[model samples]
Target: MREEELSPGEPAPRAREPVFLLPGSVSALAIILVLIQFASTMVLNPDGQNMLLYWFAFQPLRIVASLTDPSLALPLLWTPFTHAFLHGGWEHVLINVAWLVIFATPVARRYGTVGMLSLFLVSAAAGAAFFAATTLLEGVYLVGASGGIAGLTGAAIRFIFQPVLVAHHPETGERLVLGRRLASLREVFANPSSRYFTIVWLVLNAAVPLMPAVIGAQLGVAWQAHLGGFIAGFLLVPLFERRLA
Candidate 1:
């Protein structure tokens, strides 16, 4: 567990593994969400569980109302946990899983196992809060992990943008070492193809909601969820590191 730093002057400690299977907690959550949605099909058909009613639609007043009186606000507050696990359809799940798997796993690895778990829970909560407070004000209901995923994005950006700090591992007393931190954000998308991939990601997020509104079709992107979660993740990343060994 010794994490001795090898860098002459580099700040952040690098992760040990090339692939962070567990870091991308989103993958598991994504699968779970799909499964939950699938299970719901057995009891409540997709059409029955309308996104407006069944999903964790973030509505601040409603959340407060629920806290004040659960009987009345049950619909609004209760879905926060279950909502992330539900989706509109296969295409919807696939898209979310794609972004989550591609971007989130690496982020998780940097944070480590416990850090990854924090990303899932905290980001999810953040997305729920943001949606409930903002979109709910507009009487719109939102469900999904986009907000939480956004936290992952923010966390990744922080890793890219901020100063790296290293410390000793607590249990094994591993010193901070090289190959721990993903070196640079710029390095990730240095490839022309990766640049396009990043662009596509940004564009898709912006476009998801727009398509449904403008085209009169259902696009159930839940972009608010992504934004909220990302913001939460951005904050939690440092906090999590502090707790790490």
Candidate 2:
């Protein structure tokens, strides 16, 4: 007769445990990329690695040459997307995987599997294009998933900071929310965490190019790609978002 009382045949509800799980689509893609990088480094010799980079890495010089000569056009066509899967080293791939997991989880949860894949492909291509446009050198190569990860981060900012609707569970006393809504740009900036995140992201991107000189090491950070990907993700999230019912 009591509201919280269980019926004779009913079982009591279990408390929810916080468990961190790798998102399905993001994990699969990240693993594949890591495997490819590992294979390129361990299975292949130095010459083979060079050949792999030549074929898959995005090179602005190749595109420029393709303009003058039609033969180079075909390879350049797919390099934008392919280059994202290739990495310069273990550190590069690992760093990307970390970011991919953090940012892509939110995106995969909000957007369907197809939407996540679409974001990655589009962001990667946009990042490559921007890098090619800004990079002045001829022989430089761009590789890694930083651009795609940056895009995921940008897409996440669109909705992650919004106030969630929550209520105490009838019996469990646990907080629960039905769904989330996108926060307005004003609201996002008004929140200290979101505001700081946006500001820090912008400053980091701006500072990336200078990092090589600052640290006195050749850290080939494609900051242009990061900016392009972030812009693309932030602007394009609306296109991918499900219409509220």
Candidate 3:
């Protein structure tokens, strides 16, 4: 469960909040995604857009085929990272970006710019790897930032629910929130809120593949990629985070 603590003291001078609270790295990444989508939709011709997707979007069949045909090796080198910048539509991109901001903000605040980007890139690649493994020989293309955002969501779960430590200044009696302690794996499961959130997230992804039958419409959701990214983020965040004393 999440807990907030405030030290007992007089209020300190208030600082003005900036108009744009998002970190520079997050803004840069979002702008790149938006620009790519804009170019795909408005700047590029039909053939050009198709070529862009063909070369950049992750294709399971391509990886499997590349095992024997070395000519396909070129795309295998980059598609895992590139696929994240491509999206099926504006709606898909917008939704992914919105989620990215929510989950990534905390990660960026805790892990800094490099760590944040590292988690995103590594998770995106993990997602591609999982998708390729599960969908071998299937002619399908995967694109978008869902995998990376899922990773951030999982990583955020590691510490977001922890209690914040607040200490008051002995001299001026200024309220200070010292820091947040990262939850251990055991503690995460032991905590009811985090445990239930994890369960719900897993259930939602598992149900994605069955959406077509339930709603009588095909909604392409790469649940495998999401799962892979989530696992990677949840397990690998400690590598990016600083140890608390």
Best by TM-score: 3
- Runs with alpha carbons beyond 4 Å of true place in candidate 2: 1-20, 166-176
Q: Write the per-residue lDDT of candidate 3 for residues 46-124, one digit (tens) a residue.
A: 9999899889998889866878997886887899989999998999999998999999999999999999999998999
> Candidate 1: which stretches are off by over 4 Å?
1-27, 46-61, 64-70, 74-78, 137-139, 160-177, 180-220, 242-245
Clash pairs detected, candidate 3: none
lDDT-wise, the better of 2 and 3 is 3
User: Would you estimate the TM-scores of all the predictions?
Assistant: 0.60, 0.85, 0.88
lDDT of 3: 0.89
Q: Write the per-residue lDDT of candidate 2 for residues 1-245, one digit (tens) a residue.
A: 65787889898899897575877898898889889988998899999999998899888887678778989878788999999999989998999998999899989988978888889888988898889888745679999888888888888988887777667788999987756676667877898888899889979897987887779886578998898888788779888877554
Global lDDT of model 2: 0.85
Whole-model alpha-carbon lDDT for candidate 1: 0.62
Candidate 1 has its poorest 10 consecutive residues by lDDT at: 177-186
Ranking 1 against 3 by lDDT, winner: 3
RMSD of 3: 7.4
In order, the Cα lDDT scores of the candidates are 0.62, 0.85, 0.89
Candidate 1 residues 40-142, lDDT tens each? Answer: 5666765766643544544455655566688757665456655565555677667777777766776766666577667766787778875665455465555
Give the number of the best model, judged by lDDT. 3
